[model samples]
Structures are given as C-alpha cells and as structure tokens.
Target: MNVSGIDIAIQKSERKTVSIFIERDGSVSARVPAKLNDDEIKDILEAKEYQIFKNLAEWTQLNENAVEREYVNGQSFLYLGRNYRLKIVKESSGIVRFFRNTFYLGEKDQPKAKELFIQFYKEKLNSKIHPIIERYKDQLGVAPQQIKVMELQNRWASCTPSGNVNFHWKCAMAPIDVLHYMVVHELAHLIHNNHTQAFWNEVDKILPNYDEQINWLKINGSGMDL
Candidate 1:
C-alpha cells in the first residue's frame, strides 16, 4: 500500500492497534487491526506521516555504513560481537570453523561461503541463546513453549501468541550485553504484547541499562552481516 507517497507493506492480523516499522532492508511495514478498511488504514497512515518519514531518514543514515564483505583471507567477520579475520585453508574437516579468535573456512567451501557462515551463526546462536532464555524466563515469570534461532528477515527477535520466541541467527553477531537485551525483549512480550509503558517497565525491571544496548544496535546493526 502506498500512502502519502510512502510505500508500506500492510499486514492485517489479530492485533488491536496499528504499528509502523522500518524494516532492516529499509522497507516500510504497517501491521494493522484485521478489521480496518483501506480508508481507515489510509487515514492512520496519513496521520503518522511525519513519524514515518523521520524513521525512514534515520534508517537511511544508519544503513550508510552497511558492510559488504568478501570470502577471502584477511577479510573480517563477526562472532560474539567481535571481529575475526577469515582464513581460507586448503584442508578442513568442516565447512567453517572458529579458532584462536579467527574464522577458518575450507577452500573447497568458498563457493558456499555465505551458507557456511549462516550455518555457523545458526549453530552458535542455538547454543548461546538457550541458557540466556532459561535465565530470563524464570525472572520474567513466563515460560515460552519453544525457542528457535532462525532466519527472521528484518526482525532481530519476535514472540508469538502461542509463547514461542524466535531470534534471528544474525543476533549471534551482536555483543553479549546486546544479545541479553534481545532475549529479555522477547521474553517480556510473553508478559505484555505491545510496547506500552507497562511493557517497558517489565523490561526495565530486568535490564535497567537496556537503552544502551538498543542504541548500540541502532549504530552497529547495519554492519552485522556477511
């Protein structure tokens, strides 16, 4: 849907209020109440035009530093929020391996470097997030049905009505403190569905310095990619 010269992909769901988001790829999405008609949605979009434009400008500025990486020796990659130089080795038992603060990729795996890196992140994220989830679920007094580390497109993390929490594998590239904030953000959703004050209050209870992590992501997120 294009409203007021802005293109937005509209998603109608069981949600109560309209929410606008600037996706990671610089696309706009609006999640609206399923019952809203096109006219009503248009009106809402028009009303929020200023905010949307402001956010889009910010997204543009932030993504200016987006990283375009190569699968070559001396190229850097992120692991646990730290930069590690990539080394293509002629022989390796695995497609990719991390050792001594560096990423080692088998030369034969060069054709599938992106896939191998994604697999590496997925495996590492699966192992890393479980313990963090366990620690927070008990503190938040909520239990998620399941936790998954997978491709979530533009979102770093999200929670479902059924209590399932999903984290993007790219989150493995964030600093540990920022990763903790992501975990707490999703677990808090099990308690409050929206970003209301009460919902943030719940997050603040667990991570008082959460804003710092949020800012860190805003500044560094565009570079956390293959």
Candidate 2:
C-alpha cells in the first residue's frame, strides 16, 4: 500500500490492533486486524503517517553503517557484541570454532561460512538464553511452555499466544545486557501481549536501564548481519 508517497507492505492477520514496523531491510510493514477493509487500513496508515516517516528516516540513518561482511580471513564478525576477526585455518576438525577472541574457520568450509556462522550463533544463543529466561520467569511469575532460538524475520524476539518464546539467532551477536533486555521484553509479553504501559512497567521492574539496550540495538543492529 502506498500512502503519501511511502510504500508499505501491509499484512492482515488475526491481531487486535494495528502495528507498524520498519523491517530489518529498511522496508515498512503494517499489520492490521484481518477484518478491516482496505479503506479502513488506509485511513489508519494515513493517520500514522508521521510516525512511519520518522521511523523510516531513523532507519536510513542507522543503516548508513550497515556492514557487508566477507568470508575471508581477517574479516571481523560479531560475537556477544564483540568483534572477532576470522582466521581460516587448515584444520578439518570442525566447520567453525571460536577461541582466544577469534573465530577459526576450516578452509574447506569457506563455501558454507555463512551457514556455519548461523549455526554457531544458534548454538550459543540456545545455551545463553535459557539461564536468562530462568532468572526472569520466576520474578515475573510466568512459565513459558517452551523456548526456542530460530530465524525471525523482523523481530529480535517474540512471544506467541501459546506461551512459547522465540529469539532470533542474531541476538547472540548482541551484548549480554541487550540479551537480558530482549529476554525480559519477550517475557513481559506473556503478562501483557501489547506494548502498553503495564508491559513496559514489567520490563522496567527487572531492567531499570532497559532503554540503553534498546538504543544500542537501534544504532548497531544494521552491522550485526553477515
């Protein structure tokens, strides 16, 4: 849908309220209640036009430093919010391994470097998230049915209606504190499904400086990709 020269890919879903987001690739997406007609959706978009433009401008500024990483030696990759240079070693024991503040990749696995890195992030995020979840679930008094680390298109993490929490593997590239914020943010969703004041209050009770983490992600998120 085009509204006032802005292009938005709109999706209608079984959601109650309308939500708009600037996607990872810097595209605008709007999710609306499935029952709304096209004219209703267009009116909502027009009303929120100012916010959409502001977010798009911010996205453009932040993405100015977006990194296009290579699979060669000496290229830096992020791990736990730290940049670690890649070392292409001749060893065949594993596809990729991290040690001594550097990532070691098998020469034979160069073609699959992206896949290997994703798998590495997935494993690390899986191991790291559980402890954070355990720490917060008790305090929040919520027990999620399951936790998963997987590919999420436009979110760092999400909580489903079924009480399952899912985190994007790229989250492993964020700082531990940011990881905590992400965990808290999703867990708060278990209590309040929307981003109402009560939901933010729950997160603030846990991580008083949660805004710092949110700022960090807004500034550095573009560079975390492979």
Question: 1-226, model 1: which lDDT tens digit per residue?
Answer: 9988889999998878999999999999999999999999999999999999999999999999799999999999988888999999999655689999989998888999999999999999999999999889999999999899889988999999999999999999999999999999999999998887899999999999999999999999999888
How does residue 171 of candidate 2 score in lDDT? 98
- Predicted structure 2, TM vs. truth: 0.92
lDDT of each candidate versus the true structure? 0.93, 0.92
Instruction: Please list all clashing residue pairs in model 2, or write none if there are none.
Output: none
- Model 1, position 63, has a per-residue lDDT of 94
Off by over 4 Å in 1: 13-17
The residue-by-residue lDDT of candidate 2 on 89-202, one tens digit each, is 898555679999999998888988999999999999999999999999999999998899999987888899999999999999999999999999999999998776889999
Question: Which regions of candidate 2 deviate over 4 angstroms?
Answer: 11-18, 31-36
After TM-score superposition, the amount by which residue 223's alpha carbon in candidate 2 deviates from its true location, in angstroms, is 0.9
